[model samples]
Target: MSQSLQAAAQRLERWIKEDAIPLWLERGIDTETGVNIERLDVTGAVDREADIRVRVQARQAFFFAQAYDRGWCPQGKDVAQKMLQFVQQHAAHPTAGGGYTHLMNPHYEVIDSKQDLYDHAFFLLANAWSYRAFGDAAALAEADRLIAHLDKKFGAANGGWLEGDYAYACRRQNPHMHLFEAFLALYDATGNAKYLARTAELFALFQTRFFDESNGLLFEFFNDDWTRLADARGSWVEPGHMMEWVWLLDWYSRRSGRPVQAYLDALYARGLAIGQAPSGLLYDVVAENGDVVDTGKRCWGITELIKASLVQIRSGHPQAEAIAIKAVDDLFTYYLSASTAGSYVDRRGADDEVIVDVAPASTLYHLIVVAVELLDHCEGRVQAR
Candidate 1:
């Protein structure tokens, strides 16, 4: 590694360990409910009135669990346990037979009781990490139960799980992508053949349904029968997701002994060609034809791009290290805050103005994962798959 990239990686490690994790652990939690607060204002004040999403809770749990595994935070395991308990107590539907509720008010009251596939994906992910962190068999058991519930309730006949009642109009590849991620985590945690099988199944679905072989892009929305949507509805694509799939496909290949170099090459090329704005930062959304849809940029997308770059570097892409370094620099320059040590501006408009002032708790997962990946690469822990 170059001296500059090494220094940047070290700086990100310090920021994540000393600033971000501590800030979130100190100020981002709701003491009354033992759940993470949804957001923190630029001044670092908790937004108590924000509606808590189940996905955020699960994300926080996953974050702390990973933190605990890395020895970054001493209380990470305890915090993960508290957050998981909160989910089990408050997020589960009272009368519904399966799946967790979608949203809750600040007071821990159920605001939306509908089951969402995205939310459940995170729930399973959290459990998988919790079990890995603390060796808690109950967490794995809960994950199994939730997986059973998902199969029973959200399973679609065509392939993949449905998006539930939330958006019955069209199916989404985003949720299935996440479920693919969760299944991978579960397989890692337990060496369960079933979870590995599910990962393979989701990968097949991605090849057939989500991935657009014509343009080398991944479509965001799909029809009920897993057909790509037409026109604007189907044309909308997120470069961040394409980048994310690059990372996931690489990981899947490493774990499953599957060869996905062709897929990675196509995704990386397409993401670089159509995913970036004029500024070189990854754009939020674009059409399949490469028209800019939403010029707004988000922190999560940038982090995913960094991850994809790192994966490419590990895979021996010639220019990938330079790309990864540039991504790290962009992340620090645009999204990360100067005054607020750990906080970030979540979104920026096309004009470079801040669209969202509050720092979302959900973004911690993205930041943490990027930092860890960079650190691993710099420290020679990442071996080429």
Candidate 2:
């Protein structure tokens, strides 16, 4: 590896080992409950009622699995195993062909049963990671089961998986984007041809169905029949999602040895075209005609941008790296906070109140992952220079 790449990886390792994991372990981890809090305030107070989502659980599990895989957290094997068991016992529901739910009560009771391909994507992600960590056949089997179910239930006639049942039988770009994430992880972990095939198929879906080739932006939200919705709300452009698609496209290209440079460059340009304000933070949504729509700047959007940029940098796109660093710096300066007493709050609400989400595991996990990715990208760039 290049010197820059090595430094970037090192910085990411330090952040994960020093900042992210420790905070999560001390504040988010509920020793008595065996799971984490759903929402944690800036003061590190847990909100029991906020409730954990299966996706959140899966994210935490994946983090732990990563720690194990990289030898960062010793004896991480048992921790990963426990996390898997907790998810299987608490999140998995045996109904309508037995799919996972997003929200669960503190007691691990399923309060919501509606399935989303995005959530399943995370499960597949977690299982794939766990399989890598422990070489667990059962975990691999579970991942395969989830993928099979997704293919049968949510897979659209035109290649991509449908978004889910939320907001009716409507579809969205978000879920398919995440499914690509899962497929990438699955392919890397198991060398599964099916996963790679799914990845290619979904890439086509974006290129043909969702992506606005002329505008260089993705069209979010769709009808059950894969028809694009006409409402401004439906076509809302999220720069963060734009960034994510860029990264995923780059990833898919590298994985399949197919070049999508033009597509990646277009998405990056489009995302940068819709810049943010008050902090240079990317907005949550924009109009179909590229007009700014939703102004709420959430933590997840920033994370996606950072991830996308990092992917670009790592794959020999310095411009993408610069874009990512600016966005991440803005987010860190304005949004991220690490308390003196080891508490952490990664989000603030519209009213400036701490958006204390109890089960913020997924958001937290992605944030850490993105941060690590950015650090790696910068280090690589610095060394290259």
Given candidate 1, what's the lDDT at residue 320? 84
**RMSD, each candidate, Å?**
1.3, 3.6
Residue 297 in model 1: lDDT:
89
Candidate 1 structure quality by residue, lDDT tens digits, 221-281: 8888887777587888899999999999988998888999888888988988988876668
What is the lDDT of every predicted structure here?
0.87, 0.70
- Best-fitting candidate, scored by lDDT: 1
lDDT of 2 by residue, 1-385 (tens): 3444445445546666777677677766666555766766545667666767767777778877887776677745666677668767767766756568777887777888788877887788888888877898999999888877776877677667666656564677787887788888889888878889988888888888789888787888877666688665667788878888877787787678777878877887778777454465677777766676755667777777777666666557757645655665555555555552323445544543445423255665665566556554544532221
How close is every model to the real structure, measured as TM-score?
A: 0.97, 0.87
Query: Lowest summed-lDDT stretch of 10 residues in model 2?
Result: 376-385
lDDT of 2: 0.70
